[model samples]
Target: MKRHDALIRVAEYDRFRRPTSIRIDVTAGCPIPVVRTIFGAPDKPTETVVNVSLVTESHPTLDPTRKYKDRCRLARRIADRLGIDEGCHVRVDAGPYATYYRVYEIREHDAPLVVHEEHLDRLGIDGEQTVRLSTTIPQETPEQVRERGGLAETLVDDQTCEGVLVTAPHGGAVERGTDAIASRTYDRLDDGGVRASLWLLQGYNPPEGSAVTAHRRWHVGGFDRAVDGYPGLATLTGRAFDLVVGVHRSGYEWIEVGGRIDASVRERVADELRTRAGREVRTDLDRLHLPGTNPRISTNFLSKGGDRGLHVECTPGTCDRHVEEAAAALAETIRRVLA
Candidate 1:
């Protein structure tokens, strides 16, 4: 099937449903731990508020506009339901078709800028302070990592990849295939700290003879080598780009950028070819050959035995507009070769 047709099918399958909410029962006094367990940790330490509550929204089908509103309403309802004498802590996260809510309480002493001379004197600290650290890892597949313990904050980029921020209780660790990819630690004086860790997987290569792989090859280059060797690019591809695009498009939610090819670029190339051919063009990048690193466009129009199939491949990160230009260039190359 063509890439456009495949995308349309994915959209159809994601049809939205009516909104619904779920209120989880949480312990009152242990708000920090409970909140962390449910929604990871707060962006800041003093930000931890105890009177928090959590709610989830669901629907029968897609309702893009009302989804965020529904999530807000559910959060307010959870706050009202808690009905604590003190102010309630609330945070809401809503997506194209899903939403999550969290509420908690705040302790006065936890607030910063408040003088705690006695506490500081005992700890031998000079003044108010905070600590922050970040790190990431590599994985074979995103499914290899487990997400049961904490909520994940996802960052979406132009490509389909996502960067996820996960927080858990201090001293706890995130499990990734029997290995601890990240661990949360805290000191006696510290409120709590998040052990920032990341898991990256190499760019995806479709299994041989698989329909999905075949489809991807037709639209984009078959192998994604941009992220294969480099650690930074691999992390971005797996943790961010792969998650956003692959999850929504493939019906699988995980972060993995299998190759260096930019998806948007491939789509644009396919679109241009379809337009120029004045009919649907079948792309077959799988058989095309190029150097491991920098590749120059080349072609073989006639085989020793018979006419060889026309092939087109692209550089990593090529956008759709560029892909279109490249495809046109390839067509010209073919014309010259045949002549």
Candidate 2:
């Protein structure tokens, strides 16, 4: 499916993970094709056709109060629209069961931002599902973004393609201490004589107390590498690697590790996290929410054919206070697995 990037937001959820917000933005002008049939005979199904013209709005141009030029401009604006089919609906791939709904309307403000209703009947969302969907990233990076808030940087070894890549897709104030953990992990791995590559994306200037709530704005999922036009992530994703490890912060208290890495490697990492980091470690797949097992996730996509990708979710306290210990746990895992 074609993905278009739009600003997506979700309000706080209740104990059952049901969204309580009034508005949620899904996409910008992404067309969803719905097919239907027109029956000419009462008892017979006649012809089927896709109505593409319904994607945009239209009205009579014969308004007496408006000038010809103004009317023409308005007509053109209405003619150019990203459309969704009338009967075809959109599915939110944010949770276990895909929720199909058609209660969305696109508002043509500065950019097309779609607003949709909350409460997907019965689907239980695991939070990450909201941000895990893919979207297109514009090829151009804006000037103000480059100068201040959003940043993407990379340090790669050009000599070989056998190195492992470590990335923190949501870094800086977006997730607080993730940048430090990712940076330190890369450094420790390099120090331990393991060839490694690093890509860090950081966000700054979140609303005074809304740092966690604003993460969706800065988080360009690992699946979408158009991250602020840095090109580093896209380039790294294209290369063959010995392993790919993604470090992230999670709400869980225990350090959670997931992905397609071997059983033995996972056990070693869990043991290290428990011994060196002195934290509870959880590697059981059945209990992980952000397991990074999806094939499109950065760790899975960048790992050498799904054999060596590790997704490690550190608690907020660990990221803030024990970043070094967590990084050591991962660095040791990488050294033993790839070195």
Candidate 3:
């Protein structure tokens, strides 16, 4: 959508449900051991404020808007999103204020600054041009997230025929950490036809400088080599591949399908999602690709595929608990479509 054509806003939400205040912040680089979001006030009744404790090893910036834009570059690359932010407004009737704490790690200044979210008030930019998902996402602590799964070695299929690529970018501990099942799902795909993979085994933000090639190509770092101006994924795209399936974990209450490919491909993947209900497909022109205020944002590989692709988002609650089983089932469905 054009900048002036239609603007996405918080007011679009039902009057009672809209977020009264919006925040956009960028935290210090990761290996960031602690991130505490203080929700309720000391009394736990009045909505006093929301706080973020980011432990980085560098100087925090005063320009939160620029910091926010830079911080989300990798996310836009990982998820290929083009919105102001993905926020969840916790309930609080009192003064809603925010604090961002950035304690740069003692030694690791190289770690990239990971930006979280930016909204109407945070940017001071026009809301119409931005797309924001106002979700009350549960801020799960690392321990809570680790409860689902652990990190695994980044692995890719031996076959480089470039037919189908199955990926789990946020498998280990990305934004919405999954059990690394996105990568684990590789073991289930029929190796004969698909080029399966389990990359981004580490937390999201495209593990930069961690690329290793003991056997198959292992670009554990963020999208690399840049294809068609987009980074994070280069080799995987640029081919007339059949399908590129990105199995991501959704933090929202429902499952969602993103990317703008052919209608059939989108619908087929949506049909394959193993959700009981609550599914949405976001194909708006700007939304289809991860378009942010910054130039770094671009179309994600799911829609950047040779002939369009499937960006499958899994809702853990509705999906089968047995991740391997659910993943394999979804893989099989994708293979069927390729056939």
In order, what lDDT does every prediction score? 0.22, 0.52, 0.34
What would the per-residue lDDT of candidate 1 be over residues 1-339, giving only the tens digit for each residue? 211111100001011111111112234442222111111222222211223222222332212243122111222322233222122212221111111111123233233112223222211234434311001112122232122111221111122223222111111111111111111111100122211222222222222112122112111111122222212232233332111111001122211112123334334434554454333332334422321112210011111111121222222222212333433533332233323
Return the top candidate by TM-score.
2
Work out the TM-score per prediction: 0.18, 0.57, 0.42
lDDT tens digits, residue span 105-124, model 2: 33343222121112322123
Better of 2 and 3 by lDDT: 2
Q: After TM-score superposition, what is the CA distance of residue 147 in candidate 2 from its true location, in Å?
A: 8.2
TM-score of predicted model 3?
0.42
Deviating ranges (above 4 Å) for candidate 3: 1-153, 175-179, 191-195, 204-240, 274-306, 318-322
Ranking by lDDT: 2, 3, 1
Q: In model 2, how large is the Cα lDDT of residue 183?
A: 79
Mind sharing the TM-score for model 2? 0.57
Looking at model 2, residue 4 earns an lDDT score of 12
Question: Which residue runs does candidate 2 get wrong by more than 4 Å?
Answer: 1-148, 206-212, 222-230
